[model samples]
Target: MMPLATVAALSAALLALMAQASVIGDDGRQTADREALPLASIGSLLDLDSGALCTASIVADDLLLTPAHCALRAATDADCAWPRTRSDCREPGALSLRDLRFVPADDHQIAPADKFAHSRRIDRVVAHGAASADYRQQRHNDWALLQLAEPLAVQRHPPLRVAVPDYATIGGTALAMPGYSADRYYRDGNPVADVACTLGFVAAPVSLIEHDCDSTAGASGSPILIRDGDGGWSLIGLHSDGPDPRYARSRNGEHRNYGTPSSAFWPALMQLQRQRSLQPPQATDSRR
Candidate 1:
């Protein structure tokens, strides 16, 4: 679940729609480019398919970051019940990561059409060591990590850099992302790959950015990107949701998007790294 601020924003949007009777997408509403790279380099957007598909992104070479709720969402399956809604299941291992799998998409039919050209799966997922029982309800700390089975190799795609958890903002900057999603309302259709601009201000400590970036059910874990000083883009946040539900609006209005601020990312990264070392994998793949 999202935090109060996010819920408030969504509620407000819903209210506005009701008053206007002007559906967001149907009436008006709605709304990443990727370099050609090896399947390994197609690093953004990890696919976790339980019943519905969700998206995630790589924050560190070994650490793939995503909303903690996603872990709960995927666990709803009969075979994998992490008990997201219950307080008792909030403990470590409560939301199991052992059964998770990653599958890279080489076509937009798999995810975003124009943003990512290729993708590959991680060997396994490990909970971020610092994850807490309270994370399920806190909203702010909604993040997790996945350790890839192998490092990616690609002709174009490259690893993204993590920003230190500091009070930094890239106001009015150009940002892009690559993700997998299907129109929320149309649940039974193919997922599409897409891209859009991130336009907004930072709400520090909880840096928030507004963008018209289009996303759907499958795009839960896309990376938010801003160009860095060296002309490379550093990951700033993970793709989450907007004001409207999948069916309420079309690609235009409902596509208005928001994400968890990068401020929280640094801590999550450190925690994930430490967890990986303590429970080291037996091997790693470096295939092209």
Candidate 2:
């Protein structure tokens, strides 16, 4: 964990790009080992064709959560906004299941040929707000859910518990964020984790959480976690790039990262589970 005092000591190099950074003060991220329970729950969401990647974590036996933007078509300079719907903004069934994959515990710096064996296919995507051109305008509503083709093995990697009652008590609490940041990432894949960071604030008006953890592009859908009573970790928020474009100017006087609170997504998740219960059973791939 980087000292809290370092956050205010800005350098000339960082001052120029303060508003565009995901890291504050100095880089405090380190490579993490996913050989155990909680850490093993972290994985990478990949677009098999374009090779784009975003960090994700398992939240249920067969369900994982990621940023809604990760499910959209890649942005273009000509993408629409506001009054005009963004040209590539997503609609239901807009994604290709064949190309969308969730690779479990993708911490191998050099991947093995058995990559496909552990990779899971996304069978359904339930997004809250990625259907408009102005998707970037509301970064707080940027979460999405992905249902896997089959349930994950419980012994090696268990789904993380959402921080519900604990979230109400997170004032000034320390946090940890682990994900697949793209900057130093190589072909085989390695996850970087920022520990002992704290949230800047939890704004009730926007249902958003602001933090000082260091992360990057591939870490967009990473989980902002807190320690639980049982000495385990729980998910509290979903990390996004930063803030909406219009709100970027007001930084509260520090380099802060933004995310949607679980309060905003928990209800929708309950609904998704109910819907899934009614659906007929489907066949799953048996490669792995």
Candidate 3:
């Protein structure tokens, strides 16, 4: 006995509600699978001596990218402080390579008989000169690159390519953030991920990319990735910090996380690559 027009209106309203719910749900976080490609490229950046953990990504055969603060131990190092300018931030002795270790795709699943083929010791650490040692310009100068003592055996897990696309191009694109979080350590005993994250804002003035991704202490230096049309993912930004209090909270009062875009330090990375090419050949770890 219901009228056709009334039923049609009700149906349309229901559809609208469902669509709105979908959009809101999309902004929420979700964990990625253990076998995800992006997850395979990330590992824990550990302090060899102290066992302090942070996240890092394998961007090249022997190059790993992470936040400078993670390497400098900025939170506790008295010598570490932000510089007034980029030149002042390029001070040496701020980090020691001998104290670092890069464990790629490590989920702590290795058995006693198995060797950690993907783990590499730090040969050298090179942070962005523009990255301030202080919090004044932390957002802009938060990136660093670690040269592994030996190249990762590509057969295990190939390194990801850093993407230096313009901000406008990937402003609103979805991003996947995978890292070794402390919560996971206490709960699942492995690094968890939010594969359905998206770029929240591109604050160019501060040189930081904000994203709606779930991250924590150990998640620093995690890579923010975007999928290419070819079904491959590229490293777009380095997840350097957790949600900023300045930004308005989203669904669960989760403020946006921030990172240094790859474009910001592409030139320095290229220069480092060129410099490495000219260095004399040394013994490589061929375990893998």
Best of the candidates, lDDT: 2
What does candidate 2's lDDT look like per residue over 3-92, in tens digits? 212311221123334423577768888876454236788788866544566778798888888877776554433334555354445544
Q: Is candidate 2 or candidate 3 better by TM-score?
A: 2
Query: Model 2, which residues run further than 4 Å from truth?
Result: 1-20, 33-37, 74-98, 106-118, 130-137, 243-246, 249-252, 274-288
Per-candidate TM equals: 0.57, 0.73, 0.70
Return whichever of 1 and 3 wins on TM-score.
3
Candidate 1 regions exceeding 4 Å error are 1-32, 36-49, 73-93, 105-125, 128-139, 149-157, 167-170, 183-196, 202-207, 245-256, 271-288
After TM-score superposition, the amount by which residue 21's alpha carbon in candidate 2 deviates from its true location, in angstroms, is 3.5
Question: Scored by CA lDDT, what does every candidate get?
Answer: 0.48, 0.67, 0.64
lDDT for 288 in candidate 1 is 29
Report the C-alpha lDDT of model 1 over 1-288, residue by residue, as the tens digit. 344234334533443333322112332212223342112323334322323345656445555667665654323344334432545344445554533434443343443322222434455556542344442123345666676766544333245576665535655566665554443312222233333364564354444555555554556666666667877666676665555443232233344456666665566567656866899567867792
Q: Considering summed lDDT, which 10 consecutive residues are worst modelled in model 1? A: 22-31
How does candidate 2 score on lDDT? 0.67
